[model samples]
Target: MEQPKRLSRLKTTALPTSLSDHAAAFDRLHPQVQRWVRAQGWSQLREVQTRAITAIGGHRRDVLIAATTAAGKTEAAFLPLLGAAAARQDRGVAILYVAPLKALINDQHKRLEGLCADLEIGLTRWHGDAPQGPKTRLLKSPEGVVLITPESIEAMFVRRPASVEALFGRLDAIVIDELHAFLQGPRGLHLWSLLHRIDAISHSRARRIGLSATLGDKQHAAEWLAGEGPQPEIIAVDGGGAPLKLQVRAVVEPPETSPPTADLEARSALAEIARHAHEILRGKNNLFFAGSRANVEALADRLRTLSEDGGVPNEFFPHHGSLAKELREEVEARLKEDRLPTTAVATTTLELGIDIGSVHSVAQLGAPRSLASLRQRLGRSGRREGSAAIFRGYIREPYLAADADPLDRLHLPVAQSVAALHLLAERFVEPPSGDPALLSVTVHQLLSRIAERGAQRADQLYRAIGRDGPFAAIEPGDFADLLRGLGGGEEPMLEQAPDGSLMLGPLGERLTASRDFYANFKTDEEWRLVNQGRALGTLPIVNALAVGSILSFAGRRWRAVAIDDPAKVVEVVAHRAGRIPKFDRVSGEPIHDRLAGAIRDALVASDMPAYLDPVAAQLLAEGRDMFAALDLARTPLIAAGKDTHLMTWRGSVANGLFAVLLGSVGFECETFDVGVTLLGTPSDEAAHVLGALDGCPPIETLGRFVSNLAHEKYDDYIPEDLLRRFWVKRHAHLETDVADMIRRIALALS
Candidate 1:
């Protein structure tokens, strides 16, 4: 075979001698695959691909390929797997390709079909939105690959156990896409249980190959991917691309001389945003990541209006979870088309790699939720060679008058975001903190297990759920208590059989009967926004309009003329400039201590960051000035007009705990971005507060401080003692972290 031109230009970690080795590895692939590669204008395999083929084809152990987006990770995993499947020629499903998003599965299904078809290998898709024809055909044949989601797998196990066994009985491997997404939370726990259950049932050792772009700590991620199974080998592939070009610019709003009008503030903010988007994003294929769904809608609407006013083509679209699937797909499709220069204002929905083609730049409308999230969004840009990945971050800190909110005075958001950008530049991404004790998932899996195989024995249930399960940390006694609470209560979830077997109770049956039971996470009751009987999209019922309320959605403004509560529908008419509604944020993903520390350090550092634009630079300077004037960095606990501020300078979880502790002890307190605030206190007693905090109060003693502790899913079902334990397990490190904070406070006070 002739050496391809692109092969000579390939940049790989492997040395010159290793080029022959890589070639030998490529030649080992099936002849059809070789021809396919040559037909596609031949290029040498990526270093990650070469390593992946070796590990997967050799059948050494489970594999993890950590590479950048659009780096041909899919091809890397599939090439060797397909080769192995062809060589082996087993009847049952050759591979189980699991993706976090159905959209991803659909995209991969299209890409993989031709490759599979050429080799006479069958490929099928199984998801809620997928057509039934392919699934039924797969049921009959049970061969090749089946692309699916974890929820679909749960549903399959519950609804069609026999079919699942028949289809996946001889599964060769489980390839997990966007592997970092499933490393924590209920979804991660659900995936863990599902994989374990599949292994147990199939009695076959299927290799697990995990893939992701932004896995911070490779070791931790590998341990997470290897959960109770044989450890997976890490294939670390450098994200070879252009250097990242980043800038942090503050959208400075005019100062309120004396009580600014709300309407004027909103309008000016929108106008400024429009100007910024038009200035930087017009004509270029880019993405604007809004902090929230409401922000996405608002910004997209403003950009569209700017385009109309300027007589430019409307290239702006809103892409978020609240938007209709068709609308989101339309935006995605337009982005992929070469001629269309479109920009999508989106939430975290578009952060993941979903084959949306190359974006010229990525702009953050506000500070991202976390550094991990920021890194992921930044990865969306700068894919092409000889070009830097452009990231323009816009943080808006409203100008405050005298007597403005103290929080606003802090300018914490801008400081945090600027600090986050610095952290990203230093290549400091938060590693996944694995939380294995997701009782909600345990509850879900319990229901699913019993529903799938009716009347399981208590011991058998314990063995499945406790002994070797993902929730192994759950004590047997606690499991028993959980069972009693779930089964024997007024709203019983499980029924005990005469032979001491467990089955779904009335409530459990009702829950399992619903389609929503397929997922482990809890979804808020939502109302669908409709205009002229056309379904717009759904928002949480909590965010519903109250008769006269107005909100922006799908890049259009709508006024709620009527609301049908029972039907969960909001009837709206086209309107201009309604207040953007508020919705509850998904909780429990805490900021790592590193991020908080970095932000604090940034504030104290003398060097000004070059990435900060004029406004951002001003804000940073103002914050630093405040820090020095108030002597905050030196004295963490200070008093300002009968209000004592305890500058904990800690992450959310720590700050939250401290605030709760103070409030529980009957001190009027509120949480600040960088610290805790106590009201009606004098400067002289600030030392006393610090002294008291030095000896970290026991969590049990601070139980009264914990009010409205209803955060986790299925907490309602858990008993009081166990729930308390759950909260402490997640939030309380009183003896270690809190005590350390107290000592720091003591030192500062001294």
Candidate 2:
């Protein structure tokens, strides 16, 4: 096979260096591509698009396109990439697009349908929901672009290892959408290993392109995208379109009457928030980001009820992971069509760019998770010219009774929201962080490689999945220990043959055969929820539900009719009222130290944010008053009743580590958002203990105090020593933040 003429030209041509040269880059595109762009009536390419064209069309170097949502990142990447694919001389998939969510793939498929059709480039979506015929057709004559998710790629390696090279041998470009989503987690590691494996299999020096809306550090993101390949050219477009219009509203919950009435008060507070959301967002195309699935259900139900009582069309709907795909799709379709006013009260499932069309505004129903998320969500709005990005933040603070905890008195939720807003205005976003030794994903890749190759030597496995692979943090000795644990145990996941080649043991074979082997993340065991024979998505089996129990789900109330334990099914019927059902899911991202410190600053500052409404302003004032009264700026440790609260003003991780240290020293303690609570310990005793600390404790010593070490799916299969190491590495910040926190506390006490 010979090199494509376009590629050969790109290799020799000097890349455009300025805006004046953008036209020359555009001219370098396929003639038909230029015609198509002209037909679209775009007078000029966006800065991101222009830069992408020069970088991608001119060279084989990896590229990262960082821009806000609705900035035409997809077009920027594809216009140049598809040009290369169109000019390819050989058959096979020329361009591979990977996304974090299946919804994103589906959205992109629709987005690129017309363009791909115009170019006569076959576009095939390979995911769980995609049809078999198209996949089979792609398998027979692999060509054009293939849109896929990481899990599906994992599945390909396991199920169709023989076809990997044939399908990807001639690939020219690999594009990763929502690049930030794959930067930190087991899923990211899994994708990284898969990419290396693919490279090893096909030996195709594919150019990587990453598209992201929110990247705190472009260099770090570029590093992640390129892996061990050449440094990627970074095309970062500053400024999201339009001015931001923001406001923070507070809903103060009634004081707790008693332990029994606390739940009712909580419901009342939520109802008040829902009322505020309904009044402000009714009859508009907006998104209300309720933080969790439970909040989504509760807020959506209340909004729907408010609509009913007011005799208006119920435009509010709940969108979460548990909702049925069709139901979620219907909501998405309604939003995209823009025929009716739609507001999706949703969780982070809607945080990604799935093309829900132009949102009038975004309502954050609780404290914003992070500045990055706030920026991303806000990007959905103000896409239309001359429209400002509108943001409404709703914060619920306690009534701050006499008996309220010191943390609650500080009004952390409201302060966090305000700090996040201030950071957003300053254009700050938190960088991604995670354990480098994501051994759990390593286990997954090891099993997958074994299944793919039938057998492998231990050294080869380490090189492929450990030393030269994604799990580069795993040392040789620790890796050997991990392998011994896997192969020497009674129920071994691996077995060594006489030739010293490792193959799957009985347990490993059984595991790899299951469909669940493809994903490295942990998913809850869920029960299929059905109402009148229609599948209403699934609910995690958090607890047992009786026949009479009414559950709030799918933006409606339902009465439990029957439970099928064997089938993992729950039958329900319409009901008048219900309580929000519990779902086994973590609520928010870990608060970074910068945000936490910002929150503290917000509390102590006298100047108020102009974005706060009357209620929010009052809450901030009260929090400031409390801050002054306690002199928390100077007094790091304060006695509140029997508990001594040590205000670390640090992120959750540091505070958690502090609490663990306290617990290890025979002082009962717990971690709140900003500090550690030494239960029943006097302030003096706590201060003395903290002041005497020289440095962070040893990892081994800290490991003795930690529990529930298994966080990942394959963690249970790992040996206790390795599992403990993984946990400590992921959770503890001993050398940096925790050490600083220790010294700070000691200094404050002294």
| Model 1 Cα shift for residue 321 (angstroms) | 1.1
Counting clashing residue pairs in each candidate, in order, gives 0, 0
lDDT of each residue in 1-750, candidate 2, tens digit only: 334434432323224346676687788788878988998998877777887888887778899898888988999999988877877889889999999999899999998988888889999999999999999999999999999999999999899988988998878989999998888878888888888877886656788999999988877887788888866777877644788899988887675555647467546678788877889887789999988788899889989999999999999999998989999999999999999999999988889999899899999877775888888899999999899999998887656656666656667778888888888878788887665338788888889989998889999988887776347778888789889888866778999999999999999999999988888887655668898899999765332233434445676666666766446677888764333212111122567788888889999889988999998888888889989888888778877666687888877666656666666666655455677666566787877887898878775677665543455677767887877776566655555667777777788778
Per residue, candidate 1 scores C-alpha lDDT tens digits across 1-750 of 323534523334544326875797797788888777777785687777777877777765778898877677898899988878877756789899999899999999988888798888888989989999988888888898999999999999999987878888788889999998888777888898898888886757788899998877766677667777655767777755668787887875675435668766655655687787787787878989886777888888888888898888999999998889999999999988847889999988998878887889999876654777887887778777666788988877675666554445556667787778778777677765535237667788889999898889877888887766447768888788889889866769999889889999988999889988898776555568899989899764321123444445665557666776446677988764332212111122356677778777877888888888888888888888777777877788655555666778776667767765665555555444557656556666767766765466777665533433333456556665666666566555545777788788788777
TM-score on alpha carbons, each prediction: 0.88, 0.88
Give me the candidate number with maximum lDDT.
2
Q: Note each model's CA RMSD in angstroms.
A: 8.3, 8.6
How far in Å is the alpha carbon of 149 misplaced in model 2? 0.7
Candidate 2, overall lDDT? 0.80
Candidate 1 residue runs with Cα over 4 Å from true position: 1-17, 257-267, 402-410, 434-437, 524-590, 732-734
Segments in model 2 whose C-alpha atoms lie over 4 Å from true places: 1-19, 256-267, 524-588, 729-733
